[model samples]
Target: MMNATEEFDPAVRSILDAAARRPVHERRVSVDGASLSGALAAADADGRVPLIAEVKPTSPTTAGTRTEDPVDLARAMVDGGAAALSVLTEPEHFGGSVENLERIRAAVDVPVLRKDFLLEPGHLDAVKADAALVIARFVDDVGEMVTAARERGFEPLVEVHSGAELETALDAGATLVGVNNRDLASLDVDLSTFERVAPGAPADVALVAESGIATPADARRMREAGADGLLVGSAIMAGEPREATEELVYA
Candidate 1:
């Protein structure tokens, strides 16, 4: 088991503490329980790797990435052919809020994922997004967390940074595996991280490459590395949303 004080980052601790304060039932946003897995799988049906566009306002590394309205940004992604959407709901570190997710969810029809350091089962109940992000390294029992997320009617995109973590996620029955190239410890992004780990992933799982994907070339490399989808934020948020997203989606 992870020592909460030692293993959990300050941002994670803050988020969890805030979650602990709110009643799960009160925080819950009602929505139709959509299948994020089906949306991800279907994106690659036409032979093009799907783009999971992120509505990130800020981050620990790059702050203030988005200046426009959240709803406008989401609509632009949809116009750009994004198969799904990822909304950063980690308020402190990411400058994100459930309000952003709630607004984006109402603006778009595609499945939306609430991206955050999900520590408690009540965290799943906190948002109405179709899916939720669960980092494997943070939780002691991966299987239980995965089961809990599913029980809340949310598809869990289990994220791992290395080969062992990938195996742990798969063994825990995670069908949606996200390989985050950015190392949480060093906060350094090595694009090769995904490439090195992709081959080890099972063919049956929906493999998603997360972080450091900037251009169409980067997207194509992840696709060639066997990624079924790309969870991109900064690059798409930097320029014209529709054009940048369209470029990556087609790449």
Candidate 2:
């Protein structure tokens, strides 16, 4: 577990503390057996950027709560042409649960990614998800977590925010990477973050731009900046999910 006294942002520290306190338990859920990389490849083949819409009810930064069922929200995103879905499973900071991941996985044919502050190999086994997120900054041994996720049949989506973190993810042999525009330490968003860090990645590695995306223009900018996909959450979840998703997908 991350030390609370470390230089982590207060919000991030709270989330990590909550994650550390979560009881490790086995979840009875089925995976969709979909490949996040494969979905992005398919979207590329079709000449369209893949959109990995997220199923987030609430966040540490966002206020209020979403009352809709995760499955229904996921279905709406798919209906609006989302290539895959990311379900937040961290309960405290992000109103998420493994049950929601399972329900969404069962409800959608596209790939489902488990988005959480995973700390150890044991955390990977607790949920049934097609893909898993391994934040490079959050784990002590990101390589081990990446290997564990692959061992459990999950396509790991390694997330990074800076050039150093990007190198750490690459050194860990992560093929799928997400460049987050939001700085977890300060909770500041700068869309240009992806533009600065993405060019450093190899061409073969699949890159997904995460956070700070709102409109079609934002999506287009990221796509042009070498993003293979976009992972959007708050923007889509704030309103009519289907319509909000369509605007980004068709854009």
Candidate 3:
């Protein structure tokens, strides 16, 4: 059996290596009241989980979410009512890339969130390419990096896999909390995982669901479970029509 760390996903790595070569400079971008989290909130407020069109491969847990063309699939996601886009740049676990991030950014106008094990300024310095949202999975080193991202006028979409981590994310100044259902350690999808943890989320903190969403019904279940939005990837990547966005968004 492969150790948890051994199942490194290559497609996720290519993009990060590419982003590492970008010029280092603070972006002058500024978002109006509308933000990645805001969009997700707006969509979620409508009683459905607006999918963050994901362009990733099978992960440490998701063993079979592969696509022929991530760029092409990402393009389709925007057309599908994806309030925002979640590009997994961590190849080791998620098989995502920074190249895919750039491609997805160019391919769409909606906010592009760079999903990675963003732990430090060093990591931020790596993906300075073109991402509107930087996903930080709760860390003590986040305050300064959050400042860095916000100074560049980007909203940080922080991810927390559990209630404890959620507190950590909040303490790190994350207004946007993405509750990932798939345990990275186990990689198994427990559909009901977010329910108990969600009520603990601050009312002001926008709650978004991540991982294990395979159908419209799944989206609905999460929405009813108190999630403000869904960070979907594999389901959409599994191949659906552009209009299928309606299914996921309205589910």
Best by TM-score: 2
Instruction: Supply the global lDDT for candidate 1.
Output: 0.83
State the lDDT of candidate 1 residue by residue for 1-251, as single tens digits: 24466544455566556645655543544446577778777888866568899988877677566778989999999899899999998776677888999899988999999998776666677667888898887777888888887776788899999999999999999999999999776678998999998888878898899999998889988888888889999998888889999999888
Tell me the lDDT of candidate 3: 0.67
Q: Supply the global lDDT for candidate 2.
A: 0.89
lDDT of each: 0.83, 0.89, 0.67
What is the lDDT, from 0 to 100, of the residue 202 in candidate 1? Answer: 78
Across 132-240, the per-residue lDDT of candidate 3 in tens digits comes to 3443433345567667667655677776667777776677787877887876444566877788678888789888888888788888899889877788776666667
For every candidate, C-alpha RMSD to the true structure in Å? 2.5, 2.0, 5.3
Q: Point out the worst 10-residue segment of candidate 2 by lDDT.
A: 24-33
Clashes of each: 0, 0, 8
lDDT of 2 by residue, 1-251 (tens): 23345686788888988887876656533444579989988977876569999999999788899988888999999998899999999888788999999888987889999999988878887878999999988888989998888877899999999999999999999999999999988899999999999999998899999999999999999999999999999999998999999999888
TM-scores for candidates 1 onward, in order = 0.89, 0.94, 0.77
Using lDDT as the measure, the top candidate is 2
The 10-residue segment with the lowest total lDDT in model 1: 22-31
**What would the C-alpha RMSD of candidate 2 be, to one decimal place?**
2.0
